[model samples]
Target chain A: QQQVKQSPQSLIVQKGGISIINCAYENTAFDYFPWYQQFPGKGPALLIAIRPDVSEKKEGRFTISFNKSAKQFSLHIMDSQPGDSATYFCAARVYTGTASKLTFGTGTRLQVTL
Target chain B: SAVISQKPSRDICQRGTSLTIQCQVDSQVTMMFWYRQQPGQSLTLIATANQGSEATYESGFVIDKFPISRPNLTFSTLTVSNMSPEDSSIYLCSVASGTNSYEQYFGPGTRLTVT
Candidate 1:
């Protein structure tokens, strides 16, 4: 089963416009929600992360709005740029003992056109 | 955050052969994970490697197929044995970092294409 589900397999936005990607989870045990940005041929890097205690967290132009009760979260990129064109994955971390594992969403491929 | 590097960014191997991908972290870590990302699929955990312990593999993965080695806290290697065309995927190594192990950092990944 896909524990985390992401919407809009691909998206396109004009430069200076806002880009949004959404994800929903089924597991309530998830506490840490993080967004990762991956460029072709490279690894996914942490873009922004939010704990369940916070409803929202923002880093630079990237923002993560999380709703614990709804089991949903979304990523908003303000003034999206061409460089922002990449694959974005939303992940939830479930801790077991001393280790934590991430369950990733299917990912959204965003393209920002100038 | 830790700086992670993987050797042989990509390789194409023949069927039935094997390839060993190495992961190196800049600092010591208690947990390291190996993941496989197939085309159009989410990253799946292959195994978790801890220093001085046998790797813990997730379901559908066997230690005999994907043997992991964590000889020390800063280094680990994953060997994909008896490769097949279905084994063509991107293999990534990640380390648990940050306070409370709240963050995980990933290596660049090794793209393996089994022909």
Candidate 2:
């Protein structure tokens, strides 16, 4: 079963426009939600993350809007740029025993066109 | 964030052969993990490597097929035995760091192509 589901497998946005990607999870045990950006041939890098305590967390132009009640979250990129073109993955970490394992979404390929 | 590096950035091996990928972290960490990303697929956790203990593998993975060694906090190795074409994928090692520490930092990844 896919614990987390992401929408819009691929997205295209114009430079300076807003880019949004949505995700929903079924596991309430997930307390940590993180978004990762991955470039081709490279590993995924942590972009932004938020806990269930906060409804929104913003860092520069990247913002993560989370809804604890709905079990949903979305990533909004302000003023999207060509450099932002990459694959984004939404992940949730569930603590198991002494360690935590991260479950990732299918991923969204975003393209910013100038 | 922690700096992580993987040796043998990429390799091409024949079937039935084995390859060992090494991961090195700049700082010592308690929790380290190994993941595999197949062609056009998301990252899948293979095992958790902790120092001074047996590695804990996720379902669908076994120790004999993918042996892991975490001799110290700063380093670990993953060996893929009897590799086949289906084993061709990118192997990544990550370390948990930072204040939250649940967030993981990953290596560049070792791209393996088995024929």
Candidate 3:
């Protein structure tokens, strides 16, 4: 069972445009939502995250819009640049016992053109 | 956040052969996890490497197939036994940074190709 679902398998946007990727979770127990950015051969890097208490969180050019009622969240990149082109993943984590378990969504490949 | 390094960034092994991948973290962590990502697929949890105890395997994973060793808090090893072509994928090791944080830091994955 895919606990988290992400859309737009691939995306292409202009350099100055906004790139948006959406995700939804099935498990309501998930309290932590994080987004990761991965390059071709490197590990995924932490971008920005949000909890259910807040509806949005922004860091630099990246923004995360979350909706607790819909169990959905999104990553938005403003003034997209070519350097921002990479695969993005939305992940949810619910506190299990001593260790937490993460549920990841299928990745979205984002391409920003000049 | 802990910095993790994985050994043998990539390897190609024959069918029925086994390869052991090692993960080393800069700091001690309570939990270490092994994940597998097939070509163009999302990451799937293989097992949780527990310190001073047997590792906990996920539903589709088994101890014999993906044996894990967590002798200490800062180091762990995952062995893919009896590898087949179907076992070809990128294996990643991750750990949460702080007790109150929700972020996970991953190492550059080990790419295993079984022929």
Candidate 4:
């Protein structure tokens, strides 16, 4: 399996609105789901993350809703700002004996306008 | 989260030339990895850097093509040899730490444009 499918290759929203991005995985062994935010000419920064056991996690304006049985997770950005405009990626962690490997989603380009 | 830095933020290299990207972590990390992110594409892991040993490469990647060096826990390097135009891509270095080691942090990444 090892695939994390993401939807809405691009999104456009107004400032102060909510931006949502979804991702699904085929591998059940994925124990951790992480969301990353990347700006132009920059690395992907860890935005928020959730475990399979927890259904939801909130970090300030960023939240992650996870579905264990459905094998899906989503990132919700509340009060989306123009500064939040960037490419977002969803990743799943596969823990091998020696190290953990991460499988990334195709990525979503988000634009928040005033 | 660990602070990771990469050298040569962007480079334009000619065909048949090779380039080496360096990754440095602020603190000691348990694991380090090298990834390639093509234009408008997702990150594809090339190999894992094991301290004091040979790297474990993934399918579709070989040590000869992408040689890796992990002299210590806080540093690693990836060399793209005999490059072609298709080799143009952003190379990134990531590290995994913490007690459970579930989280991964990425570096700024070196953008390589082969012509």
Cα TM-score per model: 0.97, 0.97, 0.97, 0.98
Q: Quality of candidate 1's docking, in CAPRI categories?
A: medium
Considering the two chains of model 2, state its CAPRI-style docking category.
medium
- Which candidate leads the pack in lDDT? 4
Clashing pairs in 2: none
TM-score of chain B of each: 0.95, 0.95, 0.94, 0.96
Ranking of candidates on DockQ, top first: 4, 3, 1, 2
lDDT of model 1, residue B105: 93
What TM-score does the A-chain of candidate 1 achieve? 0.97
Candidate 1 chain A: worst 10 consecutive residues by lDDT?
A93-102
lDDT of 4 by residue, A25-111 (tens): 999989999999999889999999998989999999999999998898999999999999999999999888778889999999999
RMSD of each: 1.3, 1.5, 1.2, 1.1
Q: What is the lDDT of residue A45 in candidate 2?
A: 97
List the TM-score for candidate 1's chain B.
0.95
- lDDT for each of the candidates? 0.92, 0.92, 0.90, 0.93
